[model samples]
Target: MDYQFKLLRQSRQNLLRFTEQFTLEELNEVPEGFNNNIIWHMGHILVTQQLLCYKNAGVPCRISDEIINQFRKGTKPEALVPEEEVTFIRKRLTQTPSLLEEDFRNGLFGEYNEISTSFGNTISNIEEAVVFNNIHEGMHFGYLLALRRALTKTV
Candidate 1:
């Protein structure tokens, strides 16, 4: 559990780096062949973590439903995300893992409903959900990387 938490923090650190490295325009730019941009990926990662861990555990999510609707699975960027919202999402990108770690330590998640992920794994508990969330985040982080590369190529 300690290592899982540690890996999650480190992985989020990488995501935070991406957030800092891009401007609002760069983050919002959807490169060719990509359906979404860096900002959407960041938002999606935040929403996905809350949904998989808190919502699936029957606990109230720390984030709002509007965020989940905008960035959850199968969604794409419909309009430019403004600077203020980008800042909010960037703050969440750094803060969420720590808050989640604290919540898990406090046993906020006592039970989790089993969910079959699009990646094909069934998560049955908070620990599994945390672990799987990292896998999901990693996949999106990879997308973030590819999106960055594509955006830079087009520049």
Candidate 2:
């Protein structure tokens, strides 16, 4: 479990570095052929972590309902995100994994509810959720790399 948490932290660190390479405007711009912006991906990453871990386990999410509603599965960016909200998302992006690790160590998610995802996988426990979350985050990171290339018109 410690190794799982360590992987999550390293993944987030890499994501944070990738995000820092772009300007806020670049992060907010939706590439001509794309459905969302880089910032939207950031929000989605943050939202899905909470949904898969805390919300699925019947624990309250540390983030707001507004954030969850805006970036949850099946939602896309509807308008330009304010910088404050983007900052909040980035903040939580780095912070949530450690909090989850702490809570898990304390046995906070004893009754994790199993959920069958839209992608056809079920996460039945905290361990599975964490593993799935790492994969999900990596998918978004790859998409972010694609978004950056599109936005910059670079190979």
Candidate 3:
């Protein structure tokens, strides 16, 4: 479980670094043939982590309902994410994992409601949910990379 958290943190840091190279417009731009932009992918990963780890455990999520509604599964970029919102997401990307680690150590997640992911994975507990979230985040990281390439190519 510690290893899983470490990977999550590393992946998020890498994502932040990757995204930091882009301007606000580039991050918000939906490349041709893509359904969402880099910033959307970033927000989606954050929201998805909360849903999988906190929501599934019957614990309240840290993010607002508006963020969850906007970035949840199957949702796409509806508008340009402003700089302030992007900053909030970036801060959360670094902060949430530490909070989750502390909560896990304190046995915050005692029971979890099983949920099936779109990828056909079943997460029946917090441990599994955390592991699956790493996979989910990796998928979005790939999408962000592809989106970055496309956007840069068009420049």
Candidate 4:
């Protein structure tokens, strides 16, 4: 497996563990002023991989636009996601790392337009984006962990 893809797989597992015990109310809470929830963070990571890895390469995203928009960067869940949908989203996210593995093994980047990342750096290649995504995923995972702590009194 490619280094980036492997890291992504590890990240996904960590996220799954973080959310595994949370309730719908916990996943839906906005925490007063915060604009994010556990569910949103989970979906965001998946959508980002799809966009940066697949859509940017001219491939169609396996997930829907509505789901992406609801969980994309800076998007907060305005309504609770159906439990079934959340389950499906998790499964979908689990598939992304392998998709990345295939793309990296082929050594094909296709055409990715340059885009400014949250770090104020521009990434124009698929490899760079993949690396960036891994880092960002970690950051969000940390947030998810923190959210888990905040939502659970026993934590």
Tell me each candidate's TM-score.
Answer: 0.96, 0.95, 0.98, 0.90
Higher-scoring candidate on TM-score, 1 or 3: 3
Instruction: Write the residue-wise lDDT of candidate 1 on 1-155 in tens digits.
Output: 88988998899888887668888899999988989999899899999999999999999988889999999999999999999998898888788889999999998999779989878788999999999989989998889889878988998
Q: Considering TM-score, which of the candidate structures 2 and 3 is the better prediction for this target?
A: 3
Local error of candidate 2 at residue 134 (angstroms): 0.5
The better-scoring model by lDDT among 3 and 4 is: 3
Per-structure clash totals for the candidates: 0, 0, 0, 0
Candidate closer to the true structure by lDDT (higher is better), 2 or 3: 3
Error of 3 at 14 (Å): 0.4
Model 2 TM-score on a 0 to 1 scale: 0.95
Which one wins on TM-score? 3
lDDT of 4: 0.81
Model 3, span 1-155: residue lDDT tens: 98999999999999999889999999898888998888889999999999999999999999999999999988998888999999999999989999999989999999999988889878999999999999999998889878878987999
> Candidate 3 has which clashing residue pairs, if any?
none
The 10-residue segment of model 3 with minimum total lDDT is 143-152
Better of 1 and 4 by lDDT: 1
Model 2, residue pairs in steric clash: none
Off by over 4 Å in 1: none
Candidate 2 or 4, higher TM-score? 2
- Cα deviation in Å at residue 111, candidate 4? 1.7
Cα lDDT tens digits, model 4, 10-94, are 8898788768788877777866546688888889999998888777777677789988887887777788888898888889888
Model 4 misplaced stretches (Cα beyond 4 Å): 153-155
Give the total clashing residue pairs for model 1. Answer: 0
lDDT of model 1, residue 103:
95
